[model samples]
Target chain A: MTTHLKRWWPLALLLALAAAPYSALPLPGLLDGPLGSPGSLQLIALCLLYGGLATGYDLLLGRTGLLSFGHALYFATGLYATDLAMLEFGLGFVPAALLGTACSVLLALVLGAVSLRVTGIGFSMVTLAFAQAGAILVQRNPGGYTGGEEGRSAPAEHLPDALIGIQNTANLYWIALAYLVLVLAVVHWTVSSPTGRVWAGIRENERRVEVLGLRPYGFKLVAFTVSGALAGAGGVVYLLLTGGATPQAAGSDATLALLVMVVLGGSGTRWGPLLGGVLYTWAAHRLGDLANSGSVAELPSVLRVPLSQPLFLLGTLFVAVVHLLPGGLAALPARLRPGRAARAAAPVTAVPEGAA
Target chain B: MNTVVLLTCTGLGLGALYFLIASGLSLIFGLMDVLNFAHGALLSIGAYAAWWAATDGGLGFWPAVPFGVLVGTAASVLLELALIRPLYARPRDQILATVGVGLALPALITGVWGSDARPFPQPAALSGTVDLLGAAVPVNRFVLIAAALAVLLLLRLFLARTRYGLIVRAGVEDRAMVTALGIDVRRAFTLVFAIGGAAASLGGALAGLYFGSVNPSQGTGLLVFAFVVVVMGGMGSVTGAAVASVGVGLVQQFANYYTAAGLGDLSVVVLLAVLLLVKPRGLTGRLA
Candidate 1:
């Protein structure tokens, strides 16, 4: 989700990604869409959006102490902004996307300024209230701008003139996959930087960071803005995926699901949230399909599960992760990495300096 | 205005439920400083248990409430031993672990119960209506309100008048100091955790009756509202939570009423905006 993403990455990831399309691929048409069909491409676009939202969540909750339960507000704001622009004005996707991202980032700034000040549970409460309010506003307003409960769709959907030339599904999928790779690389780099280290410092001890005369607020604002913009862009992609936005886009259960996804995947790790989201989204779809098709009497009756109740599952998963895998599934990869333990242990050596 | 009154009544009942669920959470947070996210899931467990007891076992709703509380208490005791105990030393682990358990365990429940919402019908004796201010207020609503108030008052007496309550209060202030005072602080912690689970179940039992249905997702819905109450009321203060729950309940009710669109959720958004701008610590709660 980094805008000015660097081109170069480690050789391993580059080689792996380069081989993605060609190497031992799943044969086309195994299910429905071809390898690069519009459906598949749209799925990739949504995955990327999930990745970006997950990253935004991690930046605040995982890295910092702020855990806002209402981030769907920003995502919804961006989506609604895009929808409204297209409906009201004859705006193209490009300008509409940019405008959407801009408005959402501004919204995040306003929210963060307030929500971030209240750490921990208070932060969660404030954000929930904010997002719920947004959803409620859209619901009651009948024929006014938001189209009431129904919501407005993007008619005359503009696939950029540039995309029109290519028009193949594979190209769009590749583009989305590339965006995910690029965003993670940028976030990885950010975490490895001195500023990232400072953020970690602030997370551990705030009074100490202030005592050291390093202004954590500036970095926090920067982080908030960057995370907000990336999330907004992700919202645009989500808008593209669904072809519209509604107050449903701003539900607490959905947002909580996403945040729990972050925790499941490993909060601070680069790849954790993506892993979590992919698993969660897949399970959700499958479960939803099963539950809708039959009554409790059908099948094992166990399979007839509704979508909303899955939240209990999500909550339980979160609790168990904290209980057992303290570091998350993300920690497993690092444990296997060469000299990671030594590198992690190196922190023990630095503790004296940290104290000094 | 009528809407406000209606919402206030409803919100207070819900807030009372919040008090039950969050009381345990606030107590644990005060003493251990571990944010118990799984508390919501615990409430759901009680709800399901009561629902099962009432439905499959053919027990009455009145009997099911205590049954649910007991079932919730057992779950909490096990949760503390298995999930929450290990994370006691590492606060971050505790937070993440509880959150993780919160997710995975709920999944297991949904997996088992088929993830559908099933109703826990109120006893017919409590189901009749009474006239209140030219409005049709169900006898059940009054029961719910009275139940919440009764719990709150009982909790107050427990904390203020009882010996264990004073120890728990002292423990919240400073666990190490409490240990120095030679009261078994860890035992006290476990007791508080059990109490929290009990309170959560009691709330869930009430919720099932009030809604005339218990969905697995009900706990998740109440989680945020409970959090809002706990945060606004501040940690370690049950009275603050009680008051805040009523306040938020009233606010949410009014939002449901006059604001239109069946409760101006946007009003909540605006309220949060103002709250963050003004008192980030919450109206009555202290900053963490």
Candidate 2:
């Protein structure tokens, strides 16, 4: 029983974290400040939403080795679909979410078919261009459905009473937690399956996979579709939490933020992105607050300028992480212990070769 | 016919600006196999530096141009040595690092210069419109064209006449061979990057004068256009960049003239899509 528990420790730890907000047990001071505040639950919910989104993103970037720059389109598709359904079509939460996810899946299908033709850097650029076009199209708001640049919102009447009332923190937290867990299960199943093996194979060597008589394109399409649908679902959760959606939600910045989250968390690992989402969101919030305040000005003048700019820190962190910790936060535990070199040399490494 | 001539000249002038910006991008990529996403940041830095020199240094517009180019070249050299050197072999990290620099540079610019756009006054000599074959065109447009021609001529002469230029050209075709021949490929790459930086800054200064303003966000749009031109022209070919810039300029100008109000930009997106699908190697690039 002890050996079995040791093997499943990570999952067990995650479960404990999922229950932390509702546990009602007083966490120590540092944890209490971040998790016990009235608004802190919202941050957790955000982490879960982004974590699910990043996990979905990894299905392409990590699992299939495709680097798409316009993935926020799928997330936006889901949100806008939900927003339109709830506000314009007068649908309930479940129906609206279904509509959003279905729309995301359909859009993914079309995008995957066209974009999977090109691979590597060309593919990334094409995705970016398409995403920009998609954003423009949304801003145009055909038939006045998208609300243009103003964006669209879910009507208060369509939301569940609990979700509508911001005071229902526990309810919102549970729903977000459920969404994240569901995503983790789905991603875990997908990556562990035969489909996932083909994806990793494609990432390693596309030509060899082709020689093996497997049409990599079809498998890639599946991964793309799955990722889009997953990100779409995340978008729906965002709508429920925020009550609105903007075209900027699918812009380049959104894609970049998602990419940063995935990379920070360790791209290929199921749990890595979830942790990345939590850590990134928390860090951004904390660092941004610190930079905006007078406290940072007290530091050395030269350090003050860079420290105050959160983006500079984030960018520097990105470079440092890619260089120093190629396997991301997921590999840190293994790095800390003895015999680290052998573990680092393992072939199942998530870091892209020669990327450091 | 007058309107057509005016539009044609406008297209050429815009294309020249693109050519200046993209030539450096192309040259650097061809030689280093590194895509400097921060290229646009250098352009913006030049624009702002020229604006600063004109307004703050009291150097007036004409004298500030050289200062702007110098500042841009210095920044590019700093970027290459401090940030880019370590990530040479790592393509993905290079992209991310450059993107980080790209994001951070604008923030710094905004913090220093404030977010508002500042006017970049044109010199009295090039401020007015002139009649060109029955069309009233801005003298600035003519100057831009002339500047582009001058730079292109210099580049041609440098590549053809100088031993250093020969080394650069050889380095572009095959890095290993040049290295084997005992050439300092690193120094050649640094020179190319500096030249590219100067060219972009020159483009930025001209563009600032052309538009009558420089802003923190100035580089974003131009950077996108430069990237498209670099890719569309093929990665490393200066000639390809020049030709593609003109093509993009023509397409953009015509689209703005003919397409629906919001759809002008969509035309470029569509063009990029079709180009990628039909000929992924771009117009002149060998397949990667």
Candidate 3:
């Protein structure tokens, strides 16, 4: 919590990580290898993205007390924007990301202005309507760029010379880690700021926050915009890293996946998404190995099922955790760290404060 | 005039179906305030139940309808006992519980029945087509529509004319106050669950007939559409859900007919969004 510790902690982590390469290389073990490669990176990115989303969602659901299910609209918009930028304009990943996310901020403003008028389930439904609308628009008219149902693939435009020289997986894993770290830093800054405090106030009770002379809706819009921007950024990373996106990236399934990740790992917790994503990804990938063969393709056709059914597991996890572990993964360290156990034991109100 | 009549008739016909399905959704939500995401799944259950019973289950369509209804209604009862009972108070928890139950049945069905979409044929009695307004509508659909109307009438009577209905209305308005008034809240929930189950089953059966196929994935699509209906109509208002259900069905059907195929779904989504965002309630002010 101190300035000195905060400054040195990241450095220590960096140094420790640097030393990892020098140390006797640890085997991939249970989660290490050919299987874990793309899967692990995607899960890690997913965690960071959800961390951003859950925080944004919390701004409404947890903070402002509004639950908007349609946040995916902004996400999909950013994705489309990125899609065009990278695939059509041939922009590098970073610039394409900036443009897409910037566009999302604007789109969020328009969406938030209208939808944020009502809170709770209404907000959630309205947002969903927007997401559905966006999906339909893409489907109906590819506009020669949206790629319709087939979806637009991400052009591999930004791989640095350094990455090209090294193994591709290592480069991607590092990119995932770096982006995640960057997102954490931004979230920490926001959470600890005065604006976030108003959000905290907004979450407890709108009338109370309004009584304090701050407009809850306005702050909520700001929070929503920030959240949308981050989600957009996540979509960009997804497109750029995975190659491209379709309406699938922005559908209820994908958004629900993010929600599941947040709830399972711990919504409002900085690292909870990471933890939750790990659980979900592992469950999803390994569930196919029900017979212990490690490959879904290897399994008998009779036993084979679409990966979507595992969504049930993730969904179950969301229900269990919300009612059971409302605090999410961030609550873990608080429970373990010597003096923080007591703090973690307090009511759910302060859970967000210790999240990051 | 024909287009208008056609659309309105179509709306009413579709509305009848939505009413069948949504009534259960509304009743369940009304009684317990739990937004059952799996209401559609229950419909799927009913559809498959009817399908398997009548066809593979060795019964015919007429018999299958009741069988499916039983399957759906029973599943609803079991779901209430298993999950809904415990999470009655909290909205999020209730959402989660209902969703989990919804997810489970569909997954199990998918596991049992492969991923390929299968067709469930309407029995010969209802399979014939009828000509009206120059349109040859299916006999099964007309029967389904008539059956749906009967259901609406029954639901109306049940809700407006019965002691259970009065108690349910009271339960929706203030669950605690109803308990304070000496009604067994738990019993009310049980009744609601049964009513909801029947509605879901009937709706699912109807959906099965109309679509001629019922897949496990049907629940999620129907679930989202129902949520759109609920919010569009107004949360906890049976009338609102009924109307909104009709509205959604008409829009979806007509849009598909009129607009570019893929674009139509988008338009429906966009229309609902604009309407909701502009009027956070709905066409009928259902935000609450």
Candidate 4:
């Protein structure tokens, strides 16, 4: 009965979240307005969007243990391609999104083929270099397409009428919710499938998989391509939410931010990245708001300065998490339950020994 | 002809700065198996400290460089002891922690000093131009090249002659053997971090003169090129870093001048990609 309840809880939660728009519930301290208000919905939508993104990124980092630092390249590709398709080619929203996602997938396949040739830190560096190239291209704003550093906004005429204007924020929020659900479904299905077992094998010990007559490279590449594709789709949602593409979206820092999110959430776990992504996005936005609030301003300069910058606090928190919480927030519940913690710890310690 | 001469001079000067950052990066990665992402933050700290010393501390340009180097070295040492040393068991986490430091330090810098570029105080000696091969080259360029040369010579001497350097060299080649030989490899790790930080900080101080201004993001901006140099030169090889630094800097300068403005940076990245794909072991055949 308990196991059955645990399995069905997510569905129950999804239903409640879906009905959130109709409820005028005011979440004090967590949000400035009522739950159904545009302002609150917008923030929640951004959180959901990142939660989906972090989930996608976890496919590589958590499931496959491939630390590609260039995840932002694919995301930016989706964002820029979609925006440019609408602006330059006059394509409608759906077609533009499809084209952007295609671009991201194609780029991922090619780059992944090249990068997977090397393993470990070499792969990380190579991916970083490639992403830096992409960033430089966007920043260069060749032919004024990328708008250089300032970036370009989405062409409103090409977007569907429903996706535009402030009143349609709920629609955007729903779209974000749909994206998170789609990603969760895809990731959940893939992680449980045969390919996912192969990924776990590769993550634990690539040579063992090879000895078992399998090539790890192809499996790794599939993970990369799928993750990249998901990131691309997320980018389209992000463009809708923010109303534009910025060069920052294409940068190494963006990828680092994703890394922070995934790790903070707990990389390999099912709900970890999603919870992390939502909490992190919420904190980032709320911290920015709090920095501008009068109470923060009234504090001493030393206190005020660090509080003013969200990234500083976030980065420091990440460091603390790495030091104090190795398994991330996902492991916290397990830690609180001592009997379950010991049982969980047993297998985790045994796996390394078996692999070695 | 004059344009070529000027570009070459400036490129070599740029190469000098890259070498300073790359050399330390190579050593740290080689000895510790750590890609210290915070290396860039060290450079930024150095630049800020030097800028602070020269302007606010009233130390002037000549004395400010050492002050910056001292502060940067201290910070690097503290980082190694506090953050990195504890994470010795987890190699991946070490890199992540450095990434954290890399992120936080810049944000802190920006918080303290506004994000705007502060005009670097230039010494009169470095402000003037020198006639070099019919090109009016900035004296600062010559200063940078000279500083790089001195560092190269000193580094080579230390590595070739000193006992600690010998241990470092051995540690890079076979860490297990060095540890088995009853040598405390951890001490050498701290020393390497100190050396890398000092060199990077020194680069930061000189970089201010090179750019004529200091900004929080300068270290991170140069860090990409330094990574390229580290890859090209092969990890842990000082002489290799020197050669690759010159090659990368010249190529970037010439490419930027000959082709489009930003294409040079793109080309350099392309060069790194091609090089890695072609020869995974890098120039010196060092896999690390």
Say which prediction, candidate 1 or candidate 2, comes out ahead on TM-score: 2
What fraction of the correct interface contacts does each predicted structure contain?
0.67, 0.43, 0.49, 0.64
lDDT order, best first, reads 4, 2, 1, 3
Question: Considering every candidate listed, which one attains the maximal TM-score?
Answer: 4
Shift of residue B223 alpha carbon in model 3, Å: 2.4
DockQ of candidate 1 is 0.47
Kindly list the per-residue Cα lDDT of model 2 for residues B1-288, writing each as its tens digit.
Answer: 888778888888888988889888888877777767788889998888888899999999898999999999999988888777777666676676677677778767776666798889788998999998999988888887888888877887887789988888887778899999988788887888899999989988898977889987777667767777887888777777878888888777767776665575667776676678777766334312
The better-scoring model by TM-score among 1 and 4 is 4
Pairs of residues clashing in candidate 2: none
| Each candidate's DockQ | 0.47, 0.49, 0.47, 0.59
Which tens-of-lDDT digit does each residue in B125-188 have in candidate 3?
7777676777666665576568766776777787788898788777777778999988887877
* lDDT minimum window of 10 residues, candidate 1 chain B: B279-288
Model 3 residue A58 lDDT? 46
Q: Compare the candidates by lDDT and give the number of the best one.
A: 4
- TM-score (0 to 1) of chain B for each candidate: 0.91, 0.94, 0.89, 0.98
Interface RMSD of 2: 2.6
Cα lDDT, all candidates: 0.68, 0.80, 0.66, 0.91
User: Candidate 3 on A50-166: residue-level lDDT in tens?
Assistant: 444554444444444555666677778888897788777888767877899999889888888888876665666677778777766766555567877888776655534543332
Model 3 residue A19 CA deviation (Å) reads 7.6
